[model samples]
Target: MKEVKIESVFQVYEGILELPEDLQELMQKAIEARQKAYAPYSKFYVGVALLLDNNEVVLGSNQENASYPSGLCAERTAIYYAGAQYPKAKILKMAITAASQLRTTLEPIPPCGACRQSISEYEIRQKSPIEMYFMGERGKVVRSYSLSNLLPLIFDKSQL
Candidate 1:
């Protein structure tokens, strides 16, 4: 038998000030969006802001429901809106942030499995990588150059 290994690398930034101006703005917008999240059930508010190639910014906030499954994540909400509004525009960067009423989640918050796959689909369609910035309520952040870094061995159309 043969063994193989895969490694993922990302950068962690101390605070929002460490990010570039555009990324900093995106992070701020994400934080603002989080404030609008309707997370009465979980009280875990999440927000996402995406920067398109055309320099347009799109924002989304998590919307929860009593049924639970009816809710959509902030990442997907923003991504879908970007896709619908600017179908031809390529996504350049995305910033995600989360807050909770219970406690401060200090670590960078990553996307869920479905959101990762959704992001990967756009990456493939755009024929380029989408930089991701993940931030926590306390200001800690992590940056990834590509969705593949978070979703390695992704199941894409290429496999078919």
Candidate 2:
């Protein structure tokens, strides 16, 4: 018999102002993008900003569809667009922000499981770590140094 333990590491920031200047800027952009999300059903808005090695920033907002599973998350939307537009660029960092129209979200909101899987694909493709920062409408922000930190047991092409 064997026992295995899995743990995820996250860095907590009291507020956005506590972050570095560049990260503060990225978080602001994420907030702006979040306003454009089309989450009429859930009333929860999410936005993501991707920073590429080429010094380009791509923004994405959650788009909801009438069919529940038809919609794509902000993480995937930004990553996919960045992939199509900057095929040669390596994504260096990503900032995610989410807010709910129904109530004030005062804690960090991490991406869903599906988002983690989708993001792993890009991280694997670029052969580099993607620093991720996520936060709610207000309050604390959380950071993951690498996608691996969030999904310890990543399912990559090796599984195929």
Candidate 3:
């Protein structure tokens, strides 16, 4: 049998200051949203800000429910809101920031599997890549050029 390989490539930035002006602004917005996150149980707050083709900046903060799986992630929260508010607009970029109240998180924190899949749907629907930038409280940031970079073998509508 022949062996195959799959690679997920991304750039590492020392800090938010190294990013472009637009990205810096986007990240700042995400950080602000993160502060508003309701994550009393986990104490791990996450925020996401989306930049759409319509020039609108949409923000989302993780909302948790004591009822376990009832809560939604910040990524989906922002994306779904964007989809409903501007169905015709395409998503251009997404900035994500996560922090833990218990400690100082300094490393990049990638999106959970569910978030990746949810983002892949939008990427496919828009027929374009959704640039993603993710990081923790204040430190190194990771930049994925596309959602495919994060979720290589995405389960899309084509499968169903």
Q: RMSD, model 1, all Cα superposed? A: 1.0
lDDT of 3: 0.95
Looking at model 2, the pairs that clash are none
Candidate 3 lDDT over residue span 1-160, tens digit each: 9988999999999999999998999999999999999998899999999999999999999999999688999999999999999999999999999999899999999899999999999999999999999999999989999999989989999999
Write the residue-wise lDDT of candidate 1 on 30-137 in tens digits. 999989999999999999999999999999999999999889999999999999999999999999999899999899999999999999999999999999999878
TM-score per candidate: 0.97, 0.97, 0.98
Q: What's model 1's lDDT at 126?
A: 93
Candidate ranking under lDDT, highest first, comes to: 3, 2, 1
- Residue-level lDDT tens digits of model 2 in 1-160: 9999898878999999999999999999999999999999999999998889999999999999899789999999999999899999999999999999999999999889999998999989989999999999989999999998999899999999
**Candidate 1 clashes between residue pairs 3 or more apart in a chain or in different chains:** none
C-alpha RMSD by candidate, in order: 1.0, 0.8, 0.7
Each model's lDDT comes to 0.93, 0.94, 0.95
- Candidate 3's error at 45, in angstroms? 0.3
Model 1 misplacement above 4 A:
none
Candidate 2 stretches with Cα past 4 Å from truth are none
